[model samples]
Target: MTVLFSNSRNAQRYRAAFFLSLPALIGLFLFHYWPIADTVRLSFTDYKVFTGEFTFTGLKNYDLALKDPLLLLSLKNTAVFFLIKVPLQMALGLMLAMLVAKPGRDSTLLRTLVLFPAVTSMVVASIVWGMMFHSDIGIVNSLLESLGLPQQGFLRDKHQALPVLAAITIWKDVGLSMIFYLAGLLAIPGEYYEAARIDGAGRWQLFRNITLPLLNRTHVFVLVTSTIAAFKIFVPVEVLTDGGPSNATRVIVHYIFHLAFRFNRFSYATALSVILAVLLIAISVFQLRITRDEDDD
Candidate 1:
């Protein structure tokens, strides 16, 4: 009798716990899962958001998206941004991490200052950077003119727009990478550094052999995340360039925004979004596989 009563109490406790979590589970299904399912469904149809009318379009949207010259240009621009932004951000972040790795008052202060840009809102940063990059009445151009160099049209010039936007992104985001690298550096055992120092290993040799090798996982994480962030880049392009100067800075996400809201091509926008989702998933899986293989070795 006593054992049966205990079992009954335990069952009641479990039921209560599940009931307690039911609201969150329902919220997740309604907000997250349902939206994803709806997006996938809408991608296959000619959905008009304004009229709430859609026809079964099969692969028509995807076909048009593939052949769209603007999309092709956006893809190329996205690749270019990814290639340039990722390396520079990682390098700069690694450098800053190393500089602030040692714990001290000065190091703490420097780390705070370095990470300031990261905690700032991206939209605010983009707006601020937009003002800074202005040809006239902007600090950047003012400095150039002060040095006897002619003021140049930065975002207005097709050739310079993408590169300028990339630089702004790098500056705003590098601090996040720095924090990750700093954490990786801190987690390394002090004994390794002590042993290397006792053996008269130079700083560069110690870092190249010990620090860099140990940071392989951190490097992989930063690389993958930075690449994903670069692909989804929108604010800087939207606020600063609006994908202008002949679509020079029109990244994939920016192009999707232009298609969906600006032009009201809901189905086509969803198709492009599906493509982006697949691309990110593939990149993430490939990176994880590489990291796992390295670990196995």
Candidate 2:
């Protein structure tokens, strides 16, 4: 009779949990899963923009995308942006986290100030950064002049535009990464560091051996999310460069967006979106697999 009662109670708890999760499950299906499903279906079709008709065209869009020079360039540019943004953001974030991980008024203030840019609107950030990096009238150039240095083209220069955008985005996003790392850092047990110290472990040894390895989960999470964000870089390009003086900052999402909205190539755009989704999933899976392998090790 006691076992029967316990089983009944467990069933009731399971039922309650399912009921509580209903809203989020429904929302996930409606917002994320449904859109992705629809996009996949649309990817194989051709949309006649004026006539409002869809004709099934299997693999044609994919074939065209394979031949598209701009798409290739956008993918290359996105790879470059990811390389520039992710590593620097990760390093800077870890450093910032270490700096402000302690409990103090100064640390709290610094963390708050660091997070300010993250909460600010990206469009607004882009506009303000755009103005600051302007070739002629900007304060950056003015500062250079004051210091007897040559004024730079910055956003206008094809060579400088991509890296400049990467810098702006890193400044904006690195704060959130710091918060993640700070949480991970705080979670590390003090006793481990105490034991390491007794064993003659230096500061570098404690950080290298203890802090980093224990934060593996945090590392994977940060890396995967940062990668996705880096790949989808668009708002700054739209506001500042618009694929730039020579298509320098033409990242993947920006190109896909122009294809869909500006040029009204909905079918082709959907195909690109599907490709991007697959790419992100593949990258994420690879990252997680590596994490799993490390755990096994």
Candidate 3:
């Protein structure tokens, strides 16, 4: 009798827990899962939000997206941004993490200072950077002129625009990567360092052998997430360059926005979005596999 009563009470507790989590589950379905499902459906149709009309177009949208020249350019630009931004961000973040890894008042202050830019609103940061990079009256140009150097167009120049935008992204987001690396660094036991030092292992040797190897998981996480962010870059391009200077900074997300809103090619935009989603998912899966293999090894 006692055992039956306990089991019944356990079942009641489980039921209560399920009920408690129901609201959040419902919210996820309504907001996230539903939108993704709808987007996939819309990608196969000629849907226009303004007209409230849609026709099933089969694979026409995908074909058109594949053939679009601007779409190809956007893809190239996104790849370039990822290649440039991720390495620089990771390197700087790792350096900052190493610098502030020790526990002290100075370290705490330095960490806070480094994290300030990451906590700032990205749109606001982009706007401030845009102003700073202005041609004639901007501070950057003024500095160059003071040094008797030729003033260069930053956002207005085709060759310099994308790289400058990538730099801004790295500056704003490096703090997040740094925090991840810091956490990884702190989690590593101090005994390892002590053991290495006793064996005459220098700082460089200790870091190269112990620190880098142990940070494998953190590196994987940062790389995958940073790659996704680079591919989804839209705000900086929109606010700073508006995909101008001969379509130099036209990233995929910005192009999707332009197609959906400006050109009213909602279906085509949805197709492009679907493709991007697939690409990110594939990259994430590949990274996960590599991480798992590393762990196994």
Highest lDDT, which number? 2
Q: How do all models score by TM-score?
A: 0.94, 0.91, 0.93
Candidate closest to the true structure, highest TM-score: 1
Winner on lDDT between 1 and 2 is 2
Which sections of candidate 3 miss by over 4 Å?
A: 1-15, 294-297
The all-Cα superposition gives candidate 1 an RMSD in Å to the true structure of 2.2
| Residue-by-residue lDDT tens digits, candidate 2, 1-297 | 566678779889889999999999999999989998989988999999999999999999999999999999999999999999999999999999999998899999999999999999999889898888899988899999999999999999999999999999998999999999999999999999999999999999999999999999889989999999999999999999999889999989999999999999999999999999899999889989988899788
Clashing pairs in 1: none
TM-score between candidate 2 and the true structure:
0.91
In candidate 2, which residue ranges exceed 4 Å CA deviation?
Answer: 1-27
With candidate 3 superimposed using the best TM-score fit, by how many Å does residue 221's alpha carbon deviate from the native? 1.1
lDDT of candidates 1 onward, in order: 0.91, 0.94, 0.92
Tell me how candidate 3 scores on lDDT: 0.92
Put down candidate 3 lDDT per residue, 1-297, tens digits, no spaces: 566678879889899999999999999999999999999999999986878999999999899987899989999999998989999999999999999987899999999998898889999889898888889778999999999999999999998998999999998999999999999999999999999999999989998999999999899989999989998999999888899899999989999999889998888999999999998999889978988898898
Which scores better on TM-score, 1 or 2? Answer: 1
lDDT of 2 at 243: 97
- Clashes (candidate 1): 0
